[model samples]
Target: MPRDTAYLQIADALRERIRAGEWTAGARLPSRARFAEEYAVGQSVAQRAMELLIIEGFLEGRAGSGTYVRGPRRRMRIPRSRLRRLSGPGGRDNGGGTWQSRSKARTPAPERIAARLAIAPGDPCVVTSYAFLSQGRPVETCESWEPMAVTDRTPVVLPENGPLKGAGVIERMRAIGVTVVSATEIPRPARADQARADLLGISVGDLITEIERTHYAADGRPVETADIMVADRRAEVAYEITFGP
Candidate 1:
């Protein structure tokens, strides 16, 4: 190892110690000076090692106090394959946990959303916002858009209204003779904006996962697009793939 990589090596050693239960969760670590002396490294190197662990979520700093191990993270698994299932008569349960939603109708689609749905900007769309919860705590939020051109007068026009309220995109489209065949998602790491942070009960600039999802029909027409946000500390996204013989 190079001389400049000493801090990283120290971080690795600290991480190993943490996993081995040397200092269990909520246990305070030695002061930086003590760490430097124990590891035979300079104070700056020891500080860098501590900083690395903090970023990696292994440890947290308390104001006017020393660093301590973080408790185990809480995580909810979101299965990608389950997005295709509909909630209706004889439909299988989505198992996405419980959720609550509020929706507004006749909202004009934003430019970026228009591009995703392949519709003209400013076109009228039904926007439904959702907040998913676990044990009464907010875990995820989603903003879904469906162009009025496809569902203007249909029973499923508004996602949270009419008989098909709370139904999935596949079921809603199928009811209107639109056969949804495919769905795609693009996920990226992001920081929580002010509004999202408030909704998810997290501080601004906290790490989050943003997923852009789109549903399509058999005729190659776009059915719906949505932006989903989950706090990194609360959920984990997983994809399931199967090979055909």
Candidate 2:
């Protein structure tokens, strides 16, 4: 059998040690040069091994402090089934607390958002930015868009301004005589940008989960699209599917 590469071997050894509690959470590991000498590999290989562990959520890098075993992640389960339910005033009770949101109306839809809403690139839309918090700590952020063509002059033009403020997409559309039939979410792993990092209180380059979500009316009209961002170490998304009998 072909032997494992140097980095993989080193990474595996480190992983085992971590799992065995040789290095407890918050304990710093030796420098790359030291690890290379201990593992009989080049420093670059050791660095690669450390990077792998960081990406895998087993370790973290602190600028000028060195690498350390990551503490247990604080996770909140996001139920896909509950997303369609109408939320109370502030926002949905995410088992954390009432979510808070700030909104901007009459904003011109960005090109990508317009495409997602099946409208022209520069079409007017209402944008609502949400910061979901748990116990006063920011946990997730979402920016949602709705084309003006669908909600112009309607009571629901501004999502948060409507009488149904804080309601979910399906419920809000229903109030406007639009029956939302389906929703789709596509999630991708990403690195936190400067703005997001500041909002999330994490360092830039921290790992994040980005989800692109779209909701559609029964008539196949696009109703809304949103970009949701969550810190990797702060939440875990759970999808609950129920099959029809």
Candidate 3:
């Protein structure tokens, strides 16, 4: 452990002590001032160290109470299988969680989003956002965008509304005589922003997994695109691929 960074060094020492079961799960920790005194560091440094542990899922904070040891973090597995067809765009996960969604029609697409949909910037689109929770705790979030040129005035216009509600991208498009051929997803590491952190109930600056996904029609036209954000500490993203015969 590098002592140059006082907080991290303190965090390491504290983490080892926690791992040794000195403070069992649900055990209340001493106040920040107490920790600072014991570690011979400033109170702010001790607080930051505790915050790091909280973000790591080893500790939790209570509204009116001090921090306490957290139980083993349960990391849900989120599958990303090429063989599995997506249920439209926003809010798709295999974490056995429920999701709530809100959508808007005729929303204008920004420059980057429009490029993914192969449409001019400001083109009309339907946008949907989803918040996914597992065991009553937030685990993931998604934002989906689809070009109005493809789904406007159609039953699938609103992803979670109408007759084909909750249908997958392929099925929904097929209903309107459009054949979806394939989907592409690009996943990358990201840090939680204030908005995302608040939604996922995680601390800002925490690491997260971001997947950018796009669906395509038979004519090589982009049908839908989405960005999925999963809490890296509470979930694991898995990719399962099999060879074709």
Tell me, by lDDT, which candidate is best.
Answer: 3
Per-residue lDDT over 1-245 for candidate 3, one digit per residue giving the tens place of the 0 to 100 score: 23459999899898999999999999999999999999888898899898889767788766557888995576877777864437534336464778888999889999999999999999999999888788888887888898989888888898889998878678888999899888888999877888888988886666788999999999999999998888887887788787978
- lDDT tens digits, residues 1-245, model 2? 12248888888899999999999999999899998889777888899898888867899877658899994455676554534322422125458555767777788988899889998888888888888877677778888888888888888777777697766777777888999888778889888878989887777777788888888899898888888887776676666566776
Best candidate according to TM-score: 2
Off by over 4 Å in 1: 2-11, 17-57, 60-69, 82-97
> Candidate 2: where is the Cα deviation over 4 Å?
1-12, 15-27, 31-58, 63-65, 82-93
RMSD in angstroms, all models?
4.9, 3.6, 5.0
User: 1 or 2: which has the higher lDDT?
Assistant: 1
lDDT of each residue in 1-245, candidate 1, tens digit only: 45589899999999999999999999999999998898888899899898778657788666557788985464767656543323421112325567788878789999999999999999999998888777777777888899999999899998878897877888788899999998777889887778888988876665678888888989888889888887766676676676766
Query: Which ten residues in a row are the worst by lDDT in model 1?
Result: 85-94
